[model samples]
Target: MIQAPGKLADATVPHIITELPGPKARAQIEFDKQWTSPSVPRAYPVVPVRGEGCTIEDIDGNLLLDFNAGIAVTSTGHCHPDVVRRIQDQAAQLIHYSADFYLPIYAETCAELARIAPMTEKCRVFLSNSGTEAVEGAIKLARFATKRPYLVAFLGAFHGRTYGSVSLTASKAKYHAGFGPMLPGIFHAPFGHVADLKWFDEVLFDRLVPADEVAAIIVEPIQGEGGYIVPEDGFMQGLRKICDKNGILLIADEVQAGAGRTGKMWSIQNWDVEPDILVTAKGIASGMPLSAFVARDSLMTKWGPGAHGTTYGGNPLACAASLETIKLLEGGLMDNARVRGEELMAGLRAVQAKFPSVIKDVRGIGLMIGVEFDSHERAAAVEWGCFQRGVLVLEAGHTVIRVSPPLVITEDEVVIGLKLFGEAVAEAATKV
Candidate 1:
């Protein structure tokens, strides 16, 4: 295995034993069924026993090349030595339970975030335990800051599964089925349709909600779960103008698209406009339970003491891991993502060209990618086929194949993944 710079991971090779979800994992699943809710879907059967660099070994002794990156959470790769060392060091020193109390690690981590934030002129950050919690905090901060109840989001956006974030999510009904009555006054507009930018500017806003009553316009720079849809050139600028005119906060939900998962530090950096509020999670801590909602200090002041606080939010262990993760990403991981992403995207496009009937579209930025097919059945077939072969991928929306590999993945691994993906596509074509 080629060793990457910055020494984020250990120098070692990956090996496989069993297929996946070996007998050990199957038994664990049975145990999980007794305690866990079935509504939470599982994509793979392999139970990871250990991970190093860009590969994970399951309990069944199967070594699978990771392409999903733990659903885009482990951008730096599984069990990076630096991150793991940080976590272990912090755990031994102090496990947790500070609760917004004075902590050096927390302060340092927040300062690092503020330094790298899009608009740092007067920015502050509130740390949380997950992406959904970050979303919840963003909405609360916006509503409390503006003293308005209405929050405007785009269609086909997946914020999170919490009640507040669920209300903002417009693409899937299953996320909110029987979970409501959801938070009211949330409006959704058709996400910028490049085909009809004029309507998005002239008519869509009026049809959804007059800009006057809206408190915030929450969006993802690149819609992650909404099939990796990238907005047109002028879309973000238009939204920025709308927010400026209406006094609405622009909250970019970067939980899936941020933290170098894309080439840039955050997906919003690709656009000229900046968000008034930013919510991020997933890869921020390199797989630790860390998320944050950052905003201008003036807007963040809306939260009075105890207005929004979580018991385990911003614990020292998570902050320690996050601080190291930030250093690693800033050092060179992002550059690797951009370079490897271009290589992988080029390969995927070639595959798309070769299989016109099976592949409909290949689109995404940096390492966050999606391959769209004509139907979900075809997408599932391709996913199952890839899994059977060895590479692990993910499916999103109705017919989109999502591939978010660790930023540290080598070009050869990507080539192997594409080859496996091509095999899956060919098999899928035969079935069709």
Candidate 2:
């Protein structure tokens, strides 16, 4: 029988008792290949059968330390007791409800979002099922409120996969390869550079779309898929200024960096720049599927009845999970992220020092960290090395491995991850 995750977050160390993805997992993978769509990207062969805290048990009976946090979605760690309990209680009370009608939990969730809004003015929230829908809603609200046709997004930013959100995404060409006739009036500027905002005004505006015609300027305060790029304070401040100057709304895509993952309630809080609208998801509900796009009350009021509605946007179970998740975050998890992040970053830097040529850079804020290698090949090798060692991780950007673990990650867990990471890097150096 497969083992179960430990009671504590750091209970499991890197232990590979059998071949990676041993017999049972290999069979599952074989069947998955036949039944599942080929488009889904499978990072590694580890197939999880059970999870708790910060660990997962693969189908093959190997206990794996989960540093990826299910792609940084499990904020309070896998199946956090409080979040799970909330979800279970809510499910027993009310399983599903349409937001078209009044729902007590839905209103409560919105009120909570308003309480923690990063905007300067009072804000209202629009709940959704995923980050893509939140992005779509944010852009739609910006356009409806401003009555403008143009949008400005960063070159390396990833909004979502929906037509509207993907049109603003410029991270990978492949995202747009088969799709065509992209939404009109969308433009991209070099991200994380203050000077690019100036170039956007001088060049893009002078030659292409007029600045005044733009409805919103969307950006990721910390680029996730492109890389864990933490732009300087001046960069985000510049975006805010540019948006204000053009009478355009600033939309902060905080899907991957917000919800206290960056040691703050919102990722943009780290830059001290308030956005007109904010989109967040990943870690908002601990592990449940939920997302929100919050806008200034003034802008949100422009929409009347029938402007927007959702069927399952505010699932009662998910809302319950979110409320408890935010409680955990506000209570002390954010501080844990800050302290543990410092230790992890320092350890990663030491690893970089050991293999300077292979490792390029180590950067992030709080628990949202990334280790960039010199090449994609090297990054893949190191990623596989980490997986084999039993500490889970995922690659981002072209040559970067993201180190985003759960906010519940403890000091001892950080040390364990570091030790395994360093050994993986050492092994990867020789081969790649």
Candidate 3:
């Protein structure tokens, strides 16, 4: 196991030293308010100065247990020595080289991914800077390879904020409000509801876009921003069958649920279903700005030279970090996610038993757990309570609390964090 950095080795977690939004943090927030775009969302105003493992220290010297993990991006924890060492070593050697040209680290990263890719056949990867870019690439590849113009995505799915990705995203109306005339030939279906899946065949394909014209069906193995909803058994299998029968591509949007976040290397692996294309980011590079869409060699080969590319998609530094991140995941972090996830879910269920009225649902796979409240207001209150207690969490969909800590979180940390979370829920329940 990688050792903690010296500075964090002795720091007590969930350590609150001053009032939240402390002087320093307030100043930063004010300055950010003036300079940063208002479109960006802010959960709680705990300005972090540094982080190690699952602990984040704010400018006021208050230590908070980070359960959000930067929205599930830090799979291996903060400043993992192995990942940091790789970044440092790679930065010293080479930082940026156009991925358009060959780079050893780039090739190594893709090779490593091929080993763990969900496809049984040989897979090829298209690297990009973020999840949205990966999705955009997948869109293009799917259309080009299949020669189809139509696409299908689930309602409440968040692919990205870029033009094409935003067009595909249906999580919130505000995302596409005034964006208007989103790319044509895209359809939305209900997520995780079997009736909606049936509607696709009996209604959508029959009355709307024909199945032959559809290029791909993009879906999150476990919806992230939607509600961390895990679909019922056979849901994925049914989708795979549909795609196979129609010659349509299955695009698994594993951006938030992949990279060991769901206990497996990829969330789709849990269902034993192989997607035609897998788009991933978030935790792929242990917080580095990198994403990739992997596809079977046959599909990837159809894309001609210069069909699609990015300038910094496969930066050497990011690739090196990814190599180390994958090593850490395969080494032991995935197992930790599985074991700790079960323990965390059991604790959440117990908390739900205490406040059944407040918590409507609790569901997840591995560490990507969610606790749904009866109302958005109650969920927000619980979020605030957790923040006051120095446990950082994030709200999902309309009334769900996402609990996606770094995969490296220990059993002791899980116990402490959940205790605070339970207390927060109890307090929020009283308010409702």
What lDDT is reached at residue 432 by model 1? 57
Give the alpha-carbon lDDT of every model.
Answer: 0.84, 0.88, 0.91
Q: Which pairs of residues collide in candidate 1?
A: 17-61, 18-61, 21-46
Could you give me the TM-score of model 3 versus the true structure?
Answer: 0.98
Better of 1 and 3 by lDDT: 3
Give the best candidate by TM-score.
3
lDDT of 1 by residue, 133-225 (tens): 999999999988988778878889999988899999988888888888988998777785645434535764667656666789899989989
Cα-based TM-score, every candidate: 0.94, 0.97, 0.98
* lDDT score at residue 149, model 2, on the 0-100 scale: 88
Candidate 2 Cα deviation (angstroms), residue 227:
1.1
Q: Candidate 2 versus the native: TM-score? A: 0.97
As for lDDT, the candidate ahead, 2 or 3, is 3
- In candidate 2, list every pair of residues with a backbone clash: none
lDDT of 2 by residue, 200-286 (tens): 768888998888888999999999988888897699998888888889899999999999888998999998999999998989998
| Residue 362 shift from truth in candidate 3, angstroms | 0.7
Error of 1 at 422 (Å): 1.1
Candidate 3 lDDT trough over 10 residues, lowest sum: 1-10
